[model samples]
Target: MRDNAILVVVARFLIPLVMLFGLYVQFHGEYSPGGGFQAGVLFASAWILFVFIYGLDTGLRVIPQRVIYALASLGVLLYALVGLLGVALGGRFLDFDPLLDAPKAAQQTGIILVEFGVGVTVAAVVMLIFLLFARRRADTVAAGLDPDAADDVREEQQ
Candidate 1:
């Protein structure tokens, strides 16, 4: 993998652009079709591309397993906290009407926060799934077993 200089160089240039686009999709979602789901996929894709190009070990080094787990939990907590805070403020769950003095501002703030939470959770989960599968493949190959065969065995059991 290290010998592939062209792939390494191209990934270095493209990954940041992909991330920026993901952020755009996330922040601009309130006014556009894209939102947390799209942004999360984009972000996960960027990291997936990185892992595909650079290897899973490198990807894990950049973002550890514990960090991914924490991010997944934090995202859900963030979303729940926002809704609970609204309730505490005397509004219905997720109402966001009392978050700020101006109802419109509060709504906007609430939407953005919820969207961000969704994005974070989605991205973390996708990454976690990919990592798990990648690890399984690596282990299978290491054990001299056919990964496809392993998949077939699991499917047959199911």
Candidate 2:
């Protein structure tokens, strides 16, 4: 990890704010330029910044790999479950009319729920990607080799 103490402090402060902004974007998407997918990426990027500055092991300690995987799976399940609810109510897949007794409200609520799920899945997957790359880089550096050496090795092999 690059140990610029000032940068670390700044990142620590910025990360939560960015995460909070992501939530705002996720929830206010109906009336905003941002949406669940954008929010998720933003949220994931915050963590990625932390990982890059603090190191992969520290990142993992903050958010366990197993938990991230589980959350990603759960997000998919949640989205599917909402669709199933619509089916059970005699509507087509993801038809939100059955989400509530009031059809209009149901549609709105259903959209929100689906968006939430999407955000969760997107965030988790992005973070997972970062984790994998960061871990590989960390390992390579620890092995007394340049982390970028993998690219050269691959090129040579080819």
Candidate 3:
């Protein structure tokens, strides 16, 4: 993580802008090339940038890992429930015709729900993966077992 004031200032300025763009991608996905996956990545990157500027501990304190896990699970449940709703409404699985009065509107609503579910899960999982790797790397560095350290030692010996 950087201790530089300029870096922190820049990150603070850009985080909101990037997150807003991610939201745009999320909502405008149906009519544009961006979608849940892209939006999720974008959102995850915003948090990750914060982690980079600050530290993992700070980031986790801001949004605990338990919450992230819950969000992931909730996303999956949301997707499943939307599909189940169609079935419960006397239609096939994921058949959202019964969700609203207009078929087009119902389908769009279903799609949006599904996309949201995917975005949530994807964002959480990405953050989890990043946290896992960052923790491990931090530990390795702490223990002085990092591969980069080994390479450095070898170079010094040579």
Candidate 4:
């Protein structure tokens, strides 16, 4: 994808930092207002920024859709598994006491794990949405059509 040289350099430096911040938010959520949902979106937003400035194909090649889908499913599964642990221990859903035999530290650990799962799923889903929209726009452009053109122009010729 072609972009101004300065913008490319800036993005290269910024994206990694943004990803790191997301990780921090995910891990430190227990003591802060930010948590899985916010961290996930932030992580996905960095990727979206890259895609928007460069192109969808570049983004797809960097992070394939299949991988994203897998990650999303895995995240949900992880969260469900954690909750199941609580159920197996004869507690209500997501009850942390069962996670570690009623130890507060263990319960905190369980919560962190579940929160990470949520963050992963949310991030992957958001990225997937951005990918879909960007890909559609790229397709339209490749067909020699402006995305914002009138509906009549976008219609296929008989």
lDDT over C-alpha atoms for residue 149 of model 4: 45
Candidates 2 and 3 compared: the better one by lDDT is: 3
| lDDT winner, 1 or 3 | 1
Of models 1 and 4, which has the larger lDDT?
A: 1
Can you write out model 3's per-residue Cα lDDT over 9-53, one digit (the tens) per residue? 999999999999999999999999888888888999999999999
Between prediction 3 and prediction 4, which has the larger lDDT?
3
Off by over 4 Å in 1: 147-158
TM-score of 4: 0.85
Residue 134 lDDT in candidate 2: 70
| Residues 24-60, model 1: lDDT tens digits | 9999999999988899989999999999998898999
Top lDDT hit: 1
lDDT of 2 at 107: 83
Error of 2 at 46 (Å): 1.3
lDDT of 4 by residue, 36-144 (tens): 9989999999989888668877888988899999999999999999998889988878888876765897679888989999999999999988877767876786786
Q: Candidate order by TM-score, highest to lowest?
A: 1, 3, 2, 4
Ranking by lDDT: 1, 3, 2, 4
What TM-score, computed on C-alpha atoms, does each candidate reach? Answer: 0.90, 0.85, 0.89, 0.85
Q: Taking the tens digit of each residue's C-alpha lDDT, what string does model 2 give over 1-158?
A: 46688898899899999999999999999887887799999989998988878877788898899999998999899999999999998998999997689988998899898999999999999998888777787678668588477667667579
* Total clashes in model 4, counting residue pairs 3 or more apart in sequence or in different chains: 0
